[model samples]
Target: MGDTGESQIKSGQGYPVLKPVGDSAICIEFGDEINDRVNDLVYSAADALNARSPSWLRELVPTYRSLLVHYDALAADYDEVRSDLLGLAASDSAAETSSSGGARQVFELPTVYGGEFGPDLDAVASHAGLDSEDVVRIHSSIAYRVYMIGFAPGFPYLGGMDQSIATPRLATPRTRVPAGSVGIAESQTGVYPAASPGGWQLIGQTPVQLFDAQAQPPSVLQPGHFVKFVPVDESEFQRIQAEVANGQYRVAHSEFAS
Candidate 1:
């Protein structure tokens, strides 16, 4: 099965490939590589499907280069659904939307870097041949794209970290990483929405409640959105933490041209 799947992907030639997952899900793969263009296609396809509002459509999961579509097996035929997806993938609107620069939500998260909150800051600075301050400056300089949310609930897989500050994961995984902890593993950086065992090098921590089970959308960060980290002092961190606890903290955000 692995060999067949590899060969099929190899022969795709930049076209979307519909691969069945179990009996109810279809993975529409745009390409094998991960990039903004490929991710844009995934988002466009998801938007198109959502706008169509097919009765059998159950869920849409967008990733770096593909869209995992779940449908009601009992209500829809596999062949028909496959054909519909192909049409949608080739539609003019999908292509135009993917290329057009649309406004995207950019969430600004307040973070406290170094000290107890970021235990591995010194290690990362040493690895990068720079001071801890430089690492923080470079990290907070750009807006990172939320490629996908996986590994754990509301655990964002972010992209666009400056390569100079990139650091490797810890030799040993931590048993419990505090929730809202931001870490860098290789080229990627993300926040730990919930406390979980992880190996990523902890660099900073945010006070934002990334995941709230009672909220309408449990995950504050969604795929395709942008995240900007705003560095704050220890006192500000404590203040924001208090506001978050009291349900008074509103996450600062804006719509920017993507």
Candidate 2:
């Protein structure tokens, strides 16, 4: 009757707060800053809300630390939806709110680190006070966790990078960065889902397409997914590129116990 199930958990300072994003939408902010815990909260709430697709809820757009909840005014007014959101916020059932318990998919991205594909690799290493090899070693060593998808179709917001590799963006952005370009910014890394203007310091590029509207899941990556970058040589890059052009290359997939 009262939007039943776990509606009594204590919320931390990182609690979700609703704010008007537009006349028809409200943004539930999980954190004021960009961090993994906060992002997990955003995605958790969005995923749970989306699982049911309740009549009043129209859309759930999850971002780095916030989720945009769009509703139909005719079916449900602002107060009705806001109350429902508060119920979700207070839910205490671990089975319902735990981020780690949710579904996840893994994607393996092959990258050619340094050289023409990644013009900024050297600069990023230099900025971080590490040699090129050290940069690659640190980068390829960690499995990044996907927090959300935005900026472009299929573009994933990934977390879990080695803080030591954090490098500031270039003073100026490139006009066109090829799709599947892997790059680091501050404490995060992400793949450029398509050839587009971007400012993240690129360390490599993968031939696999990240966003294909033709596929069942347009974006190969999504929130709660895991990603890893496997380094490849230039020849391998050419081979994969050719395969992709010939429509034979498929983004490698595997199951994550997580």
Weakest 10 consecutive residues of candidate 1 by summed lDDT: 1-10
Q: How accurate is candidate 1 locally (lDDT)?
A: 0.87
Give one digit per residue, the lDDT tens place, for model 2 in 12-90: 4546789877667889987666555566677778777877677988888888778899998788888888888888778
Pairs that collide, model 1: none
| Local distance difference test, each candidate | 0.87, 0.79
RMSD of each: 4.6, 5.6
Residues 51-158, candidate 1: write the lDDT tens digits: 897988999988987899999999888998898888887774645465447888999999999989999999999999999999999999988988899988898999
The deviation in Å at residue 165 for candidate 1 is 1.4
| Positional deviation of residue 152's Cα in model 2 after best superposition, in angstroms | 1.8
Model 1: residues >4 Å from true position, as ranges? 1-12, 92-95
Choose the strongest candidate by TM-score.
Answer: 1
Per-candidate clashes come to 0, 1
Deviation (Å) of 111 in candidate 2: 0.2
